[model samples]
Target: MKKIIVSILLIFFIVGCGLKQTIKDTAQDLTNNTVALIDDAIDEITHESESWQATLQELSDNLTDEAQSTIRNEVQNLATRTIAAAGSEIRCNVDFLGARVVQALQRIKAELLNKPIPQRNPAICQVIPTAIDMNLTPNRRNKVDISGYDFDNQPLKLYLITNDNQRTDVTHAINRLSHYHLVLNLGSNGVLLNETSSRLVLEYKDSQMSSIAITQPVTPDCKEEEISFSPDIITYMPTHTRGDRDYGGHGPAITARVNIYVDNNTIKAKIYMRARETKSDWSTADGSGVFTIYTAPSKRRILTIVSDKETSTNYIDSGHAEDFFEKGSGELVKRFAFVGDTDGDEAGTRTRVKVTFNRVVVKLKEIGNCKE
Candidate 1:
């Protein structure tokens, strides 16, 4: 099970870092040939003009010039534009990978679920919300508590599989561990039935990820380390119009999922931020901000988000073009902080932009060696 989890991480990292060109080409050719074969078989059934028998006959015997020309034209069109993108589509295709991994995980998940293994992107990032550890002396209730952490605190529909894979959702649920009758159902006579090894598996319909993380390595100096976070998790504050002196912060107070990457030499983070624009659109997409790495530490410059169409871009050029990075502390401490100035008050005060890092997904203590 440990090896399987490790394999899943390696798979994503390799796919994310980009695969070798030769292997990519081979995979592309294989995928194309596979698709072509499936299409050829299904053509007779779908293309009502030809019967199955007639399709076979056409293959064996000579065909009319129009039919022959159709085949020739189809084969000629499979060039760079058609084949190059296929390999890239396959690399980031986690759904394809998860379908295969789910079969194996079903076998491992039946038993030994005392510890969770999906902390850092398992085949799927599952949050099986559990309650505090318990120890029963006598006359204790038999049940389990779970949370719908991934689905905005909704009731998580799942199966409670027994040691032998027997599952049921008929048990009673309350504010505490949902109670189930143990003695009435099992271990009759003088013996007591202990059903502690049961585990929860998500329903097939609810398997899609709520979001995705975009991670990148911090620097060449640091040993292989990266940060990740979903782009949609940022605060979406509507920007103040250009030349507007001062307006109330009448915007949606959304939180951003900021992922931190820390190593011996540096600490870097990736966050979802909205690009500054008069009217928000593709040009104001959060991803428009591009960071440029430099030789000196902390000298790395981050350009403001560029428009999706590349029509406009806000670059953090001047010393007062306005960007501030702060590390949090004390009782109400936050892991990281970033403030980027958009077109603030004409009075020279920086206005709060459309997005900010209100949530840090990873902590320095989790990585170790980073101090408070």
Candidate 2:
């Protein structure tokens, strides 16, 4: 544009000189001609300027659109990258890049309008892509287990990434909602999972966008079906089972598993404990009892176990006790068990006791019609 303006000025200067030399006799006419020439030059320059500006403005508009599209896609990808690994520093870098792009966009517009470019944003723009990695296979019904996630009433979205790096937004229908899981009906859409890892984007009503990154895939020894309990009962039925040998004989050689069920009212517990002998076949005991949980500190009879075979603390006829410390509602109920070798039954055959509880954690529930 500057070059064009300079060229126009040179042509006007040459034309004025020629007109002055040609009409030496007609001074008044020469003056009129010179003035006309100047006017013509000025008009031509004005028209050219407008045209040039329009072109620049058009270019700037196109470039701005391109830059915006590029930046948005790049930021999305950057956020996805952070999911497998993310932190504050990485976000800062991404924000810096975005700011630079924004600055570049402003410069493009400034050039188009022949104006000064504005300063970039001082703060880094964060693009939090809290994405969840959903693994699935083709022709399968998969429900993302959000049991490990500690969020409720959160809105969620799903995204499907194409092979060409295009992200397609997908919607999900809730099949079932439970305390430990969210069963989503993928329908025939799961066929897309045949290629890529299912990516579920979750966000809350008053929160930023969240990808399903909060869950760490863990393979538990025993996986119970997802169940729904009361809101106060944040947890449902949890089971725990463990069995191993005590090399130093610090404890007994034992194998046990316990299943605890909790709801809005009372807690029912089923426990199985056994005393095993490394050498000979020994008697084993099985017990199922009820735990009494109330606001008071009463030490009443809370347990009754029917044993298949009974054995003592030291292979004698000693039994276990039922005692616990229950806090207020919606809290953990704990029991301290000190099962030691009260009877020195190891004299005959080296043996130990094994215990397994469904879970160490017991979630308190609402007391609605609870069997007080």
- In terms of lDDT, which candidate is strongest? 2
How many residue pairs clash (N, CA or C atoms closer than 3 angstroms) in each of the candidate models, in the order given? Answer: 5, 15
Q: Write the per-residue lDDT of candidate 1 for residues 1-372, one digit (tens) a residue.
A: 976775555455445743232223323444344334424534543444224333333432332222132222232322121232123322323333323223222222221122243322212222222321123432432332232211222343444445576656522232322111111111122212343434444342455322211121222332222232323323223343343332222221222333333333343334434423332221222332222111113423222221111111133322223343333322111322323433443212343333333322222122122222
Cα lDDT for residue 79, candidate 1: 19
Q: What tens-digit string does per-residue lDDT give for candidate 2 at 1-372? A: 976774455445446653223223223543344334324333433445333223223333432322133222333433343331223323334333333333443443343333565743222122222333333332333444332121234445445544455655554543324322344444464414534444444334433343443232443333222222321222111122223322123333343333444333344444444443333333332233344322211222212222111212222223332222233233222222324223433322333223222223222322222233
Which run of 10 residues does model 1 get worst, by summed lDDT?
Answer: 178-187
lDDT of 2: 0.34
**Which residue segments of model 2 deviate by more than 4 Å?**
1-141, 148-152, 163-165, 187-191, 194-198, 205-372
Residue 226 C-alpha lDDT in model 2: 22
Return the lDDT, model 2, position 99: 33
The whole-model lDDT of each prediction reads 0.30, 0.34
Question: RMSD in Å for candidate 2, one decimal?
Answer: 24.2
